[model samples]
Target: MTHSLDPAALDQLFLQARTFNKFTAEPVGDDLLRQLYDLYKWGPTSMNTQPGRVVFVRTEEGKQKLKPALMPNNVDKTMAAPVVAIVALDTAFYEHMPTQFPANPAARDLFASNAGLSTDTATRNSSLQGAYLIMAARALGLAAGPMSGFNPTMVNEAFFPDGRWKANFLINLGWGDPSGNRPRGPRLAFEDGVVLA
Candidate 1:
């Protein structure tokens, strides 16, 4: 029988979690990065289309490469963070469907025949995977600050020059410094944003 997560677990993953703007000096090791991917990859996606691709920018050179792409408000904090993850989507994600979703090999052809459908699928599912990355990091006692204040063209030129992958957003990962966080922002009530059929 499955059980719901305890309150503390829920808080850690969602409720009490905050988008950190600053982090401590601790380094996010490569091992932890691999572990983070392992945890989040299990999250469900349409047709199991795991289209998310991540580039962990931990080196100073990598940070410099990312600098030109960031908006003014996002640059300093991103540079200070231990690791900045460039979450992207693979445009040709359907190529892997034959392996990832072998139960329905025809699904690959269905996506390939329609450009609009493939793009929509990649964008939606990859965004979901990026959210899962944040939750996975939080579950592992790390803080995540996801941002979209960057020039996608610049990011794509700097990181994904081959053109198979496209930038979706960025996530700065580390041990957060509470002193630098702004007061928590209020969220919309369920009734305000949800609709029941």
Candidate 2:
């Protein structure tokens, strides 16, 4: 499906999606979360070799399991958020590359025999997907808090055993409490961060 976003309108969503440190004691509905996932899962991936695997920590038990995995500063806010998503990369993402990258048989063989190549592709593509998920959530009028301070090994052990998934990052989702938002952080200016040829 061909889709396009108006740059100006997209910027508005970017402006709204700020880090939410606090949230109301409200819960996000499972159906809404599912819808969000459905939308995000369709975002582009390298060769369409989708590598993202999301573990939604919604239940009290699941949230409790996440506590031991989060850094001290992130634990309380994570627990309080309506949803904490554990975004992971599937190590075997390329197994289906024959179909996803069918245009070139070489694409299928590219990572088939090399463990390092498979791992690198999965990590990079899943990271890209995670960013798309954040934008999709923002477009849906949801607040997001993206974080990297977490124990990946612990998260994998708690959520995925047998090495099926590798944790990438954690994103808390819910309606924002204006009182919980941090001031917009400074960003590098275009000239400072980007160069045009």
Best by TM-score: 1
Candidate 2 lDDT by residue in tens digits, 29-121? 998888898888888887888998888888899999889988999988999999998889998887777887788778767777888978988
Candidates in order, TM-scores: namely 0.98, 0.90
- Candidate 1: residue 51 lDDT (0-100): 88
Clashing pairs in 2: none
The 0-to-1 C-alpha lDDT of every candidate, in the order given, reads 0.96, 0.86
Stretches > 4 Å off in candidate 2? 1-8
lDDT of 1 by residue, 10-60 (tens): 999989999999999999999999999999999999999898999999999
Clashes in predicted model 1? 0
